[model samples]
Target: MTDIAPPSPSSSAEPAHDRQNLIARQPILDDKRAVFGYELFDRSTAAAAHTAASDAALLFNALSYAGSEALVGRKTVFINCTHESLKGPHLELIHPERVVLKVQTLGEQATPEQIGELLPVFESLRARGFRLAFNQEVLRRAYASWLPQAAYIKLDLLAFKPELAEPLIKFARSYSAAALVAEKVETAEQYERMAALGVRLFQGYWFAQPTVIQAQTIRPSQATIVQLINMVRQQASLTEIEELLKKDPTLSFNLLRFINSSGFGLSCEITSFRHAVMILGLKKLFRWAALLLTTSRNTGSPPAVGQTAVVRGRLMELLAAELLQPEDCDNAFVAGVFSLLDVMLGVSLEQAFESVALPQPVVDAVLHGKGVLAPFLELTRACESADEEAFARCAQALHLSNRQVNWAHLQALAWAENLDQDE
Candidate 1:
């Protein structure tokens, strides 16, 4: 759960409008078990029927609130759409090649005529370069009009008996040219079975689950990343780090934003990469780089995980500012941001820490849950989650009032939102 700021006493107790958008994504993997794209949906309205309004809201939020890069990055995005939404103006906002629109049926028993009526709509979308995806229902003879337009066909493993999947797979392969995607695949057996049946794409919890690291290891790849890690590992000179930052525009931009972020508690803005490096010094810059890479990496985690970490880091820093020294506040921010490193890196925190050398205080709070900053970290998490009891306990432990915490929480949310907008 991302730590969302609570409303202030002067404001309405109702949640913010954007908070209600609550977007969630599931990774779609290829045969090599690498993430190929994502299936994004509105978690806030998961139980609601698929309607024009719901479809519009999901697309609008994904584009506006979540931002494209933060949501799916460079990966293909699969969005569910109602027949009505298929003709919506919202679909115009997306780049056709990057998005695959999953068309939903009218109901459990939609007629052949009803499905055929949307053929023109489907054709129009394809003409505009948008790819279409359909459920296993499209394999039925009744949905023949819809089959030819399908670029991908999804098979929900849990929707039918195990033996039934193979025949459906065979039937789809024999008749249609669409790529088969096995959905709701929950175990190694399910994934293997789907692969053996010639299914190349998969979506489910089995591959999405974070890897449990039983031993310490470093798996840095890419020349730039390896160089950066090596530089940090060797405690290279400031000049060397600055030269490297100058070579990579993306890293330079991230560095400037990171040091000047509201949570960093800087009195003035940092305008240059060199200035930021000198001000933050070598150690803090390494921490910032670790965070930037962890969140920005294409590690198959949703953009929300990185976004949530930024919020937590800012929230904790703001909360710490009220009671701790400036240095401790800085550490608090790192602790908050790095708390989710395990999930973002697809490894345990123990293994994540083994790869990067973070401050001992941040490590203690995140890894062992024993340190001066541990209670504040707990309080920050409480603000993001719905555990009211834990919230009160942690807040009381820190001797802070609800108003103070709420104010910080709200500020952190706004800060993170602003950062996304800048991006």
Candidate 2:
């Protein structure tokens, strides 16, 4: 969607199904257990009884690339790369230093020459502030070639028989690669063993599990919004707006951070929120902040809950055009955003409605599921539950095409992904 160059790998693997399983990140730490970076990991439950590492690096790279603008505000992200990437469009957009590619040395008999042949690619990347690394198993003999070329390398402590760690550690130290990580180290004894061998980066259940980092909420001071709304519409002077912003220190500080963030690529350095206002003007600024308000409130709602509301809202609007009339889509969109506002805001709909006003019918549908949108909302919920019979009835009743319903599912995912990236 960001005009990424179309990639064609013609991979030996087939198309994947069942994206239900979640992916998590493992912290790449130092010997002191200080946070150094994160290693991306994926699990696939395509079957009930089995799940393991499935190559999700392609999707991970795409999601990370898409989410970088938002995530860059705090930490440096280390995205994983696959064997295919050394030759593709990924190199064009992302630098190597910011990424620690998880490459493997191929077959068991792979030689140092094979790894050395990839140096020209790594050298070009290093010139652009990129970093390279290998993962899991690496041969003792090939270490001479692979170790010299990389900044960091990871080896699973469990993968190597316990006795093999000493030699592996000795081999890793020979080239003095910046770091060697021992992953899947579960117990304190295992950790102590790796640490003694000088494996600084140890990752496993011993550390911590990945969590959905709560995006901080911006509780705009009542006065901040009042002043912003007033000054923005009048197209007030920069000095006057700066004086007004002095009313809310937090708003001013966050506004500066947001403008300076990768999300907004301003050509010149902006030192003040007033300058940000001057650059963006009131209309754009207000819309952006309002969206920030909504996204800040994304909270911990299950993703499927949000996706269903979007599909329901869109479907209802489409139905409105057929059965009701024009001028109804806005109501529908508002309905979608507010459907779970009570849950997201931690207050009943009645209590939350006092803070934000909506058209009566829109509020009715959200609060009581009563109005034209209600029926569509019901249908969307059924599809999410995979209720085939309910979906068929709703599709028939609404005269909606199967393709139309499926298209809405994808659209919802896209919209959520965008909202996620923007946040």
Candidate 3:
């Protein structure tokens, strides 16, 4: 898991998955208890946890899947980076202004040679508008030479004794340019202690725990999307679809907005529902409506959750493209996207199924996790969760190669990220 911005702090509703890579964001708060930013941590996927490959995947996923607009917006993004990640191509994918590279001091002591090697990299990043964060352990005399580059100093409240907190705070303050952060603070007393030491930034459950929202009530607009999906499945004419959309101004507005979104690739604006229908056609409209079901939420869930659902849908569809008939691909897509309806609609899977008129296969795949599409859904979940064994089994059962699954996973992530950018 990494901090790729999942659900909102108070609404912890997540997409349902048997296996998937978990990405959670822990809020970092300012002195006034306002959200400052987030420190991203990954629990799986990377070889050694903080290796270059994992870091690159996290960064790329964050930028593509969880953009700055969704996560921090204008706030700081504190990402832990190893020495190698500094030189990797993924770092170049994002702008540096809002990112704080938490450079890990490799050893207990930093040699002159190591310092010499890192300073130039630090200088280059700083010159390009990136800030560097350091842990308190970097405060040792052996690593003092790197102190000048520090932007934020993180102090683990759990690691340091209460008495040493003040000394560490004082020492961190001596830098004048660095902000002190007290992380892993779990109690009111710890927060108070850190506050007294002039630590303006804080992280931990003391302020707020990550809320888990299992499901959310579907909005009126979402119900319209369900209606539109039904209409599309029945092969309704443009006039009929347009009439249904016209009934709900909000529905019409969102359809137009989505069609105009960057993902649609339209040169001119689509001002009318009829025009949108003509441009997207029936099949594509069904897909778009399916996507809108999650994205156009009146519920307080994070947008990332909806985007994650979209990724799952795309991944399933991509996996089925080779093995299943062309018509079955649409069912696979619907199954994948609507699989999270139980969570997205705040209802049981059976109850959620009532809203959308889906095929028996799609229904079976989603409700019982049994059907031809079920393994694709499972493999898609495995990709997200990084369940290598499950992924292998599902892929093999479906006669899909490791490279095929990996390629589809990457494409789905890119597709989801592009969808967000289009909006």
Candidate 4:
């Protein structure tokens, strides 16, 4: 008979309030069309209101919880901030050099005086080694006070007429040393026009859209990951886990790297699998395994897919914790993480499951879509899609409120972002 331990305590606690925000990132490109950096934004609100609380949530989620270093690596991360947010304490948490604060106006019709008043804030930010980005309005003579400290001047191609590009570019060149960035460049012609005008940096869909590349065959390490998860689920002995780890060096390396990562918040470095198991315990070890399963893909899938999987897993785990037994929550997490095995491994769900034995509840939720955990998995997936009716249906079916679902969703996103993809 198989000995299955009871589910471990929930790894995450619910938030005090439902402070939910949808985070999205757009890739900024250079003249050669190579990715330069990402413009992180909040998709929860339609307009870029630039409120202090919204700004704080975006930056806090990115820098503190998301592990900005792991998310963007050494690339500069451009974040939108209000004038008030610039003075807020959130800026203190970031590595100023790695972040470029895109400063926005106080209101839609911000006056020259309003812009002039924040010149000192811009200067102070520059003195602290932080860079500032501004929009085309900074080129106007009325806002001259804020132009000199600009690191980047973003020209909204959609907002400004094409005929105004050269003049604006010339004005910006003469007044500020900031590089011109053409945002919303949606066509090859726009890219060419911008390049001709000496606009070297850009952000838009003209360069490339986000995609998931499917591999024809799975790697050995991927198989080992599946096997390891199975072993952990069955409560395999430490020796067995160690032997499995030894068989796959990639998995072993990733395991150590993940445990030692800044997100894990360990007091001491963990060197071996036995030490990791001893320190993290089987329950926590299972969480790490789920995370590694997504990120350790030697396959050609983009890091975004792995990142998305981690979020799904964590979201399901958190949601399940609300109503299900601890063991069911564990299965819910497995179901969620492995839900995208098809996309990550580039195989059919059945083929992916054939490599290793998984819990039937998880299998039912992912493959058959009929089980106790199936509704949770469905609700988790609906949160990512555009089908609002479906999301509403799924949430209603599960008795999960919008606030409850959104809170869990945001927490999952942050948890996933905190995972370091190093190694």
Where's the lowest-lDDT run of ten residues in candidate 4?
Answer: 8-17
**Residue lDDT tens for model 1, 1-423:** 122121122111112222344677888999998889988876655455556656665654454334344456568889888777788654544458878999865665887677778989989999999999999878878787777899999999898888897899988987888999999999899888889988999998887842221211112222454456567667778778765653333344345444443224356655544577788765555444443333232323125766687788888988899889987886787788778877765768885554443568888999999898899899988998999999999999999999999999999888776643332
What TM-score, to 2 decimals, does candidate 3 have?
0.47
lDDT of 4 by residue, 128-158 (tens): 8999999987776677787888999999999
Q: TM-score, each model? A: 0.47, 0.45, 0.47, 0.47
Q: Estimate the TM-score for candidate 1.
A: 0.47
Q: What does candidate 3's lDDT look like per residue over 1-423, in tens digits?
A: 121211121111112111133345678999998988877665434435556655654544343233223444456677888898798544543557657899878685656787679989988898877899988887877777778888888898887789999888777677547888888889999999889878899998887664321212233344556667777777778888865653343354345444553223345655455677887766556545544453444433234556677778788878899888976886787677677766765568886555333567887888888978888888888888867888789889988899998898899889766642332
lDDT of 2 by residue, 1-423 (tens): 123222232222222221222445557667887777665444432333221113333322223222323333333345555454565432443333455566666666756677667778767776766667776455455545555667777777667789988887776676655577787878999999888876667778888665322222223443345445556556677777764443333344345545554334445545444566777655555544432232222223225544444455554555555556554554655565456556544557775554333567776777887887666666666666768999889878878878887776666556555533322
Give the runs in model 2 whose Cα sits over 4 Å from its true position.
Answer: 1-21, 44-73, 76-78, 111-116, 209-423
- Winner on lDDT (1 vs 3): 1
> 381, model 3: CA deviation in Å?
31
User: Between prediction 2 and prediction 3, which has the larger TM-score?
Assistant: 3
Instruction: Tell me which of candidates 1 and 2 scores higher on TM-score.
Output: 1
